[model samples]
Target: MPTLEDEIRRLMADETARLHAAPDLAERVMRSSRSKRRRVRVAALATSVAVIAAAPIGYLTVGSVAMTGQEPTISVVPEPPPIDDTPPVPTEPPNLGDLGDGREFGHVRVGYLPERLQWSQRSVDNGDRYSITYNYKGDDKGSYRVQIHMYEEEAVQEVDDQIQAYRGEEDGEGVTVGARSGYLVVQNVGEDGMKGTPTLFLRMGDRQWAEIMFSPVYAEEFSSAEAVDAELKRIGEGLTSTM
Candidate 1:
């Protein structure tokens, strides 16, 4: 027995109740919105990652153009010093002529010799001084002779055609031996039973000196005066003294 106004109000109340939300409906809607926003942010981050990862590949594609203004670097190494492995050259000895065997005597020795000559067995000994004579083995007339004299004391006067007589002879020819200071004389001696041959007088030291008178035998044997001179010097150099 309700009126029409009461019926209409009851219908409006039913419709309002139908449109009303549940107690946690606003919270559920808020959570759904937050989840959608989070999904969007994740998608944006993935897209940014893809772009960042592609950057190095893009740079490599344009690598030559990017390095166009810069020069390429290079490494260099220096060369080492060369080694010197060559051997040193040796020096040669001097060329001197041939010399014969040695003959030793009183206070002296003759180093080189002439062939076929022997001691004449005639020697003169005067207290502390001596004289030795050499000749060809069978030539008795004394055509070629070598007389070597030695004195114990220096500056002994000429006794029996000895020291001073030969020391004073000069024929304008002078010679010097190596490392020995002495006077050498070559005299055109006509005496001593010789055939006017040449003589070589080498007087050195209180030593053995040969007042050599080879005579015309040597002059005939030699080709020139210079040859005789060279032979004379060779003889003198071969003479060595003990005193």
Candidate 2:
């Protein structure tokens, strides 16, 4: 048989082992629940932080569109102006008689073709023996006139070149009439029809020359070229022999 003290000691040992085996079970469960709640709170806090970070970017994009209302502005510029054109006219027809007497030693003659046209003769004192003959075919549609000058060979050649350059070669002839040797330049002049006009230039010396010009507006109006030739021949006959 066991003693009473021994049995009491054995029972106390069993109770102590059971208490140790099931120690603070509720407190442990409560602690695990509290830890899970803290972890959830921390996860929520992290999500809230992420939302805060993304909010500013979204707000800025929406704010930019709202502030502008539409699109941005642009500018443009304009242009400038343009320029002019036209030609000049003559004042008066040269006077034949005055030019002859003033330039030539007053050795001049004026005549009409077919005795119908009015003509004049003048001279210019160019320090040389020279004369200018002016034939006026009246101021009308069927009337034309020309001025002729007689001067030195060089002077005559220069004038001839100028005339040739102005009106290209048509017809001409060389002649040694009286004491002068020169050429007669002829052309058909008129916008409507051909009016045969002849311009004569005689080079008498190195410094002396003579010119004869005939311009007919309606050359058909004249009796004949022979008549014009006769007039020119008469004028040639009238040249001064002493120059």
Q: Could you estimate the TM-score for every candidate?
A: 0.44, 0.39
After superposing candidate 2 on the true structure, give the runs of residues whose Cα lies further than 4 Å from its correct spot. 1-146, 152-154, 160-170, 188-192, 218-221, 241-243
* Tens-digit lDDT track of model 1 for 1-243: 997655655665665568784645544555786688666666655555555466543221111211222322322234456788999889543311122222665566776555566666555656456655567768774434555555555423443143345555533344566544344444555567544545555555643344444556645677877776676667678877676
Cα lDDT computed for each candidate against the true fold = 0.54, 0.51
Which candidate should be chosen as best, given lDDT against the real structure?
Answer: 1
Return the top candidate by TM-score: 1
lDDT of 2 at 20: 70
Overall local distance difference test of candidate 1: 0.54
